[model samples]
Target: MEVYSERQRISNAVEVLKERQLTVGLVPTMGALHEGHLALVRRALDDNDIVVVSVFVNPTQFDNQDDLEKYPRTLKHDVALLEEVDRERILVYAPSVEDIYEGNTISQKFDFDGLEYEMEGKFRSGHFDGVGTIVKRFFEIIKPHKAYFGEKDFQQLQIIKKLVEKNNIPVAIIGCEIYRETNGLAMSSRNVRLKPEYKEVAPFIYKTLLAAKDKFGIESASEVVKWVESQFSKQDLLRLEYFIIADTNTLKPVEEKTNKKSYRAFIAVYADDIRLIDNIALN
Candidate 1:
């Protein structure tokens, strides 16, 4: 439960841990701690001698300023949650924007071998760039041996893997399974912003994903898209933004299963102003 807002202090602390040859794990996050995030932390704790959960609401990732402002910042609550996880092994790094970006909060451009031009990238212009920038900065700052990421943002997870590959970063990147609610709705920080009515209907997104998963191998990938679209069309409360069955590796939308490659359904839906995204693997 030691929390550090200054980069230099945390860096120094991490350096000391490294000198002791203690294995360190990094769990990068944007505040608003949910069970989804804690799952990553708990796993990191299991795998490493120490876990550092960075809670900084990154500004560069948001294409819309309103969304950035509205994005929850709950470091105090987040720390409390981490303290509950394990007070001694978990170190919380809650940095300010100025502390993270050093006054200029602009994101760096990355190619990601055109991996950035897909689903989330197409919608949130500089989103992955911001993600890469911040995550890279954390890797530099923390220098952890292992890092954990949830598969909820499967595309982003792929991009991060590419980031490490491109830069030759030494850290091992781990993607954990998506944590869902008892009703099947994917756990998300944005779930806090869902309207009461929207909350009731939000579980439909996962229900449709489950059905789409069922149809993935049987139906054409394009047909699965159509079925998902029709299912969402019948619902008036939530709007389906985009749903594509993409290869688990390259993330290119496929019309039919080819070459024994794995595929997964990636979706983004709007519960009014709050956007929710989820994915499920299709084999």
Candidate 2:
């Protein structure tokens, strides 16, 4: 895999690739890659002639300084994993903070309005803006024919799709499935932070959502919420952040009157300060 730390080198490499008429696929990621991230790379490799993965821990996306500080960084392992996937076809661009955002000012910010203000957005203020800014920069730099994102971050995926449409960026945004472990817990880099006991119980998050989906059909939203809240309340080790069934597209609280429509049960919990997020769609 070719590694480029500077913008000029990356730009030149991309230009050469373009000159050769090779179709490019870009997978943008914050490092500490896991099976989920590799799944994305594998999919990209299948679809395009050249695969480029940008691993930069975006500073702007984190709402909490401690969370940002604690965010995992395993660059040596991440590169090894990429090379294992495909050494010849893969290109790794792992740049410094200064290299990415050269100037102090970033002009573009995507305002998703209602979409931005709900769910994860509500908890992490200006988080999506930071996501938008970095993603836009990466998109511009790579100029890939297609870009891939994992469906685990469904809301963020939706927002990026909207950004591409609104901005007229000429790249197809592809979302791959949420890769999980044997226990049904969605694969996430943050899973590394979990305590041994908490990691074992982590699969319960998915199980809870599955149970909640069944209850959604027969019960009111309030009842469902109460049941979910009680489930976490009883689990003394689990620190429930938010358990909500919201409009899949809007991420807003679905009214009881509108319960007939499709909804998604999204949950974020803290087990020993290692936050885990998961969601399940309901009809």
C-alpha TM-scores of all predictions: 0.98, 0.94
Model 1 Cα lDDT, one tens digit per residue, 1-283: 7999999999999999989999999999998999999999999999999999999999999999999889888888999999999999988898999999998989998989989999998899889999999999999999999999999999999999999999999999999999999989999999988889999999999999999989876889999999999988999988999999998888999866876898899999999999999999988
Flag clash pairs in model 1. none
Pairs of colliding residues, candidate 2: none
In model 2, where is the ten-residue run with the lowest total lDDT? 103-112
Indicate the worst ten consecutive residues by lDDT in candidate 1. Answer: 254-263
Quick one: best TM-score, which candidate?
Answer: 1
Backbone collision tally, model 2: 0
TM-score of 1: 0.98
Alpha-carbon lDDT, every model = 0.93, 0.87
lDDT per residue for candidate 2 within 162-265, as digits (tens), equals 88888899999998988999999999989888888999888888899999999988998878989999998888778889998888777788776374567888
